[model samples]
Target: MTAKPMTAAGASRASVLFPAVAAFAIGFGLIFMSGLVQAETLHDAAHDVRHATGFPCH
Candidate 1:
């Protein structure tokens, strides 16, 4: 059996689709993990990020 070559349209659709699907999966995973993290832990991380970026988070 021989594998069929991908058409131009099929390749274009796949290129667009893969990123969208990956982004959605990453976003969903982050949201799910955020829910499981403690509030203080989250706040501390945010605060550290803010300070690291030179944004005063007083």
Candidate 2:
């Protein structure tokens, strides 16, 4: 089967715009969801890391 050539508008819109839009949407969703997650501070990570390292951060 042969592929038909795309119209000028279709080609530009598909190649340039669709991927740019999809990437922007993915980045926006990631940033938006990150705001919903609880972030740990250095002090919070210290204990976990210490225990994992067999150091016992207490």
Candidate 3:
């Protein structure tokens, strides 16, 4: 059986798709890891940033 070469459109789609998939995977992994942390710990870490952004934590 002969193998088909990738067309320009397919190559372009793959290039865009790979980075998007990689980014989604990385983001999901980070959220999953953060979920394992205690709520208070996460709150403490983001406390300063929240206040800086004028977000009320109280």
Candidate 4:
């Protein structure tokens, strides 16, 4: 049996809020509870290098 997909036609305004709240909860948990990203990723390192006072890499 196939599971039915959800859609906006059946969703209320508060349903949209659920995803935003879930995202915030995940971000908050990762930053505060897990400490998972304190070590810089490549993107973070590159971003820092880009912002280092001399040039706008735009």
Clash number by candidate, in order: 0, 0, 0, 0
TM-score leaderboard ranking: 3, 1, 2, 4
- Report the Cα RMSD per candidate: 6.4, 9.8, 5.6, 9.4
Off by over 4 Å in 2: 1-14, 36-58
**lDDT for every model?**
0.66, 0.59, 0.68, 0.56
Model 4 ranges with Cα > 4 A deviation: 1-12, 34-58
Using lDDT as the measure, what is the rank order of every candidate, best first? 3, 1, 2, 4
Error of 1 at 56 (Å): 32
| lDDT of candidate model 4 versus the reference | 0.56
Question: How do the residues 1-58 of candidate 4 rate in per-residue lDDT, one tens digit apiece?
Answer: 8966668576666877898899999889754422333434633545555456433433
Best-performing candidate as measured by lDDT: 3
lDDT of residue 23 for candidate 4: 99
Q: Best by TM-score, which number? A: 3
Alpha carbon lDDT at 25, candidate 4 = 91
Error of 2 at 28 (Å): 0.3
For residue 55, give model 3's deviation from the true position in Å. Answer: 20
Clashing residue pairs in candidate 1 are none
**TM per candidate:** 0.39, 0.38, 0.40, 0.33
Off by over 4 Å in 3: 1-11, 36-58
